[model samples]
Target: MSTETLIEPPLQDADALIADMGGRARAAAKIMATAPTAKKAEGLRAAAAQLRGQADAILDANARDMTAGEANGLTSAMLDRLRLDAGRLGGIADAVEAIAALPDPVGAEVDRAERPNGLVLRRVRVPLGVIGIIYESRPNVTADAAALGLMSGNAVILRGGSEAVRSNRAIHAALAAGLSEAGLPAEAVQLVPTQDRAAVGALLRAQGLVDIIIPRGGKGLVARVQDEARVPVLAHLDGICHTYIDAAADPDTAVALAVNAKMRRTGICGATETILIDRAYAAPRAIVDALVAAGCEVRGDTDIAALSPHVTPASATDWDCEYLDAIVSIAAVDGVAGALAHIDAHSSRHTDAIVTEDAAAADRFLAEVDSAIVMHNASTQFADGGEFGLGAEIGIATGRLHARGPVALEGLTTYKWLVHGTGQTRP
Candidate 1:
C-alpha cells in the first residue's frame, strides 16, 4: 500500500497541507506532460481493467461509506451522490475505458501562423501542469479527475469531502496501482490524504506549484474556493438554471419540458429552479396549475398564489435561489424581453432554456441569454456532459473565458505556442 494519506484529518493549517500536494503534483505533472500517448492510454486501460476486477471490493467500500454517511445524518441528495451500486461501478469502469479510447488532447496544434519577418508561430495544446480539485461526496470524482488529468496530460491533486474519505482513498489507490503498473509516475494523480479543511487553503495559494484549481460541489464550497484560491480556478457553481415558457411556445412542449426540468431529478445542479411564464397566452394560473399538477411546489407573486392555492408567496430571495429539490419558484412575465430581463438579473449563468415554437423567439433567447448553455424547446436538465455526447464531464464552467458549458476532456486542456522555422530569424 502507498504511504500517502489519501484523506488527512481536518487540520487548521490548510495552506501547508495544500502546498505539499501542490509540490508533489507539480513534479508528477512535468513527467506526465512528456509521456507518450500510447503509454498514457495503456495506463488508463490498465486502470479500467483493475477497476473491473475489483468491483466487489469497491462495492464493499462504498457500502461502508453509505452506512457511515447515513448514520451521520447526510441528506437524501448527499446519500444519492455517495452511493455506489454494481451499475455505477460498471459505469465508472466504462468511463475509464472510454477515456483511454479517446484521442489525447495534449500536443495537438490549435493554430499556426507565419509572419512576413521570417517568424513562424504555432499554438499547440499542453498540460496545465498541475490541477487541484475540491469536490463534495461523490467518490466517483476520484476516477473522473484521474481520467481527465491523465488524458489531458496534467497531474491532479484531489481533495474530496470528508463524508466519503474512505471510499475516495480506496479508489485513488486503484488508480495509483494502475499508474505504477504502466510504468508511469504514481504522483501524476495524487489524492490529498486528509479531510483537513486547511488543505483547501494550501491548494488555493499554491500559485506556481498548482496551475489551476477546479471546485465541483455546492454553492458554499464553490464560493469558498473562488474567494480563497490564489490560483486560477474553473469554478462549477450552483445551477440556478431557469426555463422560460415563451409567448409562442407550444403548450405541450412547454408543459413536458417544464415538468422534466423541475421534477425529473431535482437534486442535480442542472435541474431547473425557476420557471418564467410568458403572459401573452398563459396566465399565472395556467402555468401554476400545470406545474403543481406535476408535483412542483410553485412559489410566485400574488397572481400565481391566486391562480393556484398550491403556490405560496415568493420572496425576492427566491428569485436567486438554486432549489436543488422538488420545490420551484414561478413567475409571470410580459414577453420575451421580460423573460430575458429576469434571467439576466437572477441567472447563475450556468444553464437556462427557452421553450418556444417560434424560430424568431428561440433565436432571440439563444442569442441574448448570456448563459453557458441555452436550450430551445428542451429541458435545462439536459445541460450535462453525457447529454452533450462527451462521455462525462468534470463539471460545468459558467465562466466565459477558457471553458464554458460542460467541462469534458477538451475543456481540461489549454493551448501552447509552438514554432518550427528553417533557420528563420526576426531582423
Candidate 2:
C-alpha cells in the first residue's frame, strides 16, 4: 500500500509450516542449551547491529503495514503499537545489545547441597527449550522475544499478528541474518511466515515441539491460547491497572503521579485505567482538572462529575475497563480501604499503585494488595521490563505460576538437578 514491495511469507500450508518451524526450533534449542555464553552474546550483538544497519528497509516495511492497518480499521492504540520510527527502532536495537550484556542465566547455579554419604547435589538453571512467542502488534516484540529466548539458551519461534505482518517479517529478517552470520544455528529464530489463523492452532498444539507458549496480545488471543493450547502457557491478560491517591497524598505529587500514570502514554499496558482519589485528599479536584486539561477524556463518578463539566458520567463497566486510549475513569473513595476494595474487585491482578506520604499507609497498601507488581508513591507507568532493568519483557505474566510481572531472562529459564558424585548408591 505504501508502494514498498511487501515481503511475502513462505507459501507452505499453515499446519505443515508450523510443524516445520517447531521441529527446527526444537533442534536448535538443543544446540543452544549448551552454547557458551560468549556465543549467545555474539549472536545478540550481531542482531542488534543488523537492526541498525537495516533500519531503512525495516521502516519501509513498517510504512506499508501502517497504510494497511489504517485501511483495516485497526484501533489507534494498536496502530501506535505497530508504528515504528527510527528512534523506536534504535531503542529496539539498544535493548538487544543490553540483553546481550546480561549475564547468561543458563547453567547458573540456583542451589547446592551435600548428603551425609558425600553425594554433592546442585540445581542449576536451564533453558525452557523451544519458546513459541505469539504476540499481536508491537513489531518490536519480534526482536525482543528472539533476543531474550536466544540469550536464555532457548530457540525462539515468533508468530506475530497479521496487522504488522510486513513489519514483523522485516525485523525478523534482520535478526535471522545477523544470528546466522554470528554462527548460531539457522533455526535459532524462526518466524512463522503465514498470516493464517490455523498457524496459531498448530503452534498451540505443538506440545512437545514448543516447550512453552507465551501469548502477548488482547483478551481474545490469550483466551484462545489458554483454552486450546495443550502446551504450558504464560498468559498476559488485560492490564486493568489502578492508581490510588490516598487521603494523605501530597497534592502536587498526586497530580504529577496521576497525570503521568494515565496520560503519559495511554496505549501502554502500564497506563493506569482507574484513578481512585480519596475524598479527604487535600485537592482531589486538582487531580481531576489536571487529567482533563491534558486532553484526556475523564469519566467520573457522581462527585467527580460535579467537579468538572467536562467529566462524563462513568458507567458501572468503566471501572472494569482497560481503556487503552486518551480516556480515564475516575472515582472518589472514602480512603485506602475504599480504594483497595475497588481495586480488589476490578484489578486484573496485573499492576497497582498507591500514592501517599504516610509511610504507614504506604506500607499497609504495599503489603496488602495481592497484585503481581505493587508500588507506593510511584507511577504505574514504570511497570515495564525495560524499566525494571531486565532488558525487555516477553509480557507481564498475571497468572501465578512459573513467573509473575514483567517476565524477562530469569523468568525464561527453569532449573534442573545436577549431581556430582563418587558412585554413592542407596544403602
- How accurate locally, in lDDT, is each candidate? 0.84, 0.91
Q: What range of 10 consecutive residues in model 2 has the weakest lDDT sum? A: 1-10
Global Cα lDDT for candidate 2? 0.91
Candidate 1 lDDT over 42-132, as tens digits, reads 9988888788787777887787788788778888778888888889888987888888878888888888889776568999888878888
Q: How many residue pairs clash per model? A: 11, 0
Per-residue alpha-carbon lDDT of candidate 2 for residues 33-152, written as tens digits (9 for 90 to 100): 999999999999999999999999999989999998888788898899999999999999999999999989998999999988998999999999999889998999999999999999
Q: Which residues of candidate 2, in runs, are more than 4 Å off?
A: 1-13
Residue 119's lDDT within candidate 1 is 68
Task: Tell me, by lDDT, which candidate is best.
Answer: 2
Looking at model 2, residue 260 earns an lDDT score of 97
Off by over 4 Å in 1: 1-20, 283-290
TM-scores of the candidates in the order shown: 0.92, 0.97
